[model samples]
Target: MTSRRSFIKATTLASAGLLIRPSALLPVSSRYIGLQLYTVRDAMQQNAAGTLQRVAGLGYNAVEGATYTGTQQFYGMNAKAFAALLKQQGLVMPSSHYRLGAEKMKGADVKGTMLHGWDKAVDDAATVGIQYMVCAFLSPQERGNPDHYKQLAADFNKAGETCKKAGIQFCYHNHDFEFQQQNGQYPYDILLHDTDAGLVKMEMDIYWVTRAGMDPVKLMNEHRGRFPLWHVKDMDSTPERKFTEVGSGTINFKNIFKHAQEAGLKYFFVEEDKCPGDPFASIAKSIGYIKKNLV
Candidate 1:
């Protein structure tokens, strides 16, 4: 575990060069501490109910999901049943991750993904009490010319409409790839510029932003209210920059979290894409540190 003194030191140092306004120093506005279920993918695959119980036991009141099965089920349960299961554990899933389905699919053979059966996906999300539905990742084959992102922006706007009708916010989650320059333009910037802010919000992954050598606070300041959900994952200090427990890493979450209001952050989830050991134990350490500090 990273000690309180070390955490504060990291925060101060990271905040040193930036101009910190009084408002920026205020604590994060929302108190709904959340976890991304993908962090415990193996455990979830084995036993979702038990995994969620452990998550709630670790003091997480909320969760963000990453898996939506081909059968349109969540962890092997139907939308309503999954929602009920979450309620049983006193957990509310405010956000979930979905993908862009096959670019070309046979009639009525599509799964509930952004590109194919979005309406159904949104409907199921609503059933699960999910307020945010995020396009989780872009597969390698999906990546093409810069025009693709523009088309994606259009698709996102369309998807956002469906989600809006269902009272769900549609967002896109980012990885470091989005930040890389493509034909002298960052795809991420294109997404931000082309999309309707009200329609297509963002689920900013802090670790990836930092991994790409970008400042999360700066992005927030540049595009206010564009981000409503955040993946509060962390990067280690070493050159390899592996995923680590929240406070145990080099990322200065304290400073970044203080600017939550600027980011339009409503709910933030702690996520470690790959953990060093027992995933539950990793999250337990993360939540403990967050409760004592970040949240």
Candidate 2:
């Protein structure tokens, strides 16, 4: 009984609406806020279950884990158990840090045999519903020379290939060390240029980049869509430049977040490696500020 013209108009409007991204319709503040468990490492080491419960109560809906591989357990709980715990707390672990073992450094051809226990690590990570497996740090021995970094980049590609098989991503988390120049070139540049974009991605730690006197926004512009994860920490305005709660420090998070699309940011985890007092108190303050100001 509807008029033909009215029906056509409705169809056209519906088709137009379909072209808009669903995320564009939501408020920016509606995005999920994740906490890196390392921020509460001490408490988590003492009582992971209790600490995670407190984290949930503090309003964090997602978490990034720091303990895996070495422990073969997530904060003392096996993969399945930990996944269940997360569901109970209304939290999801989108990413977790896993150190690249010595065996993994042997190169792609020998990755499977050299890297002992990596298969289990990947399997466990997938079981826990992790989307990204991050190479958290490079030990002094692993990063001694320029050649070492090149090898590391190859290893990262191999690791990424492994993660891809499991339906997960592989990423590298940086510290200021990578920015240090060796013979005129930065190791970070070597890694970025050498790795396969499809196989490996980056998890930029804004605090570390700032500490290295580099610009995060510029990096995002240079490597569009390569970074999907971020470590959201802040630096104090003091000359010494110490760690501070998010938004409480001098870092312009609002400005950095404005380039989220360019950085391929899907999630960011708040981290505070050093805290003056109770870690919980620090995280609470940081999250409160983020919600009110930066999102």
TM-score for every candidate vs. truth?
A: 0.88, 0.87
By summed lDDT, which 10 consecutive residues of candidate 2 come out lowest? Answer: 105-114
- Lowest-scoring 10 consecutive residues by lDDT in candidate 1? 11-20
lDDT of 2 by residue, 1-295 (tens): 1243234323433432322354663333245789999999999999888888999999898899998765688888988798778877878788999887773444622221215567777777766777788988877856866788888889889888877776678999999999999988999999999999988999999999999999999999999988889999999989989999999888899999888888888788999999989999999998999888876
How many pairs collide in each candidate, listed in order?
0, 0
For model 2 the TM-score comes to: 0.87
lDDT of each: 0.82, 0.82
Candidate 2 colliding pairs, count: 0
lDDT of 1 by residue, 187-294 (tens): 999999999999999999999999998999999999988888899877888889999999998889999888888888888899999999898888999988988887
List candidate 1 stretches off by more than 4 Å.
1-30, 103-110
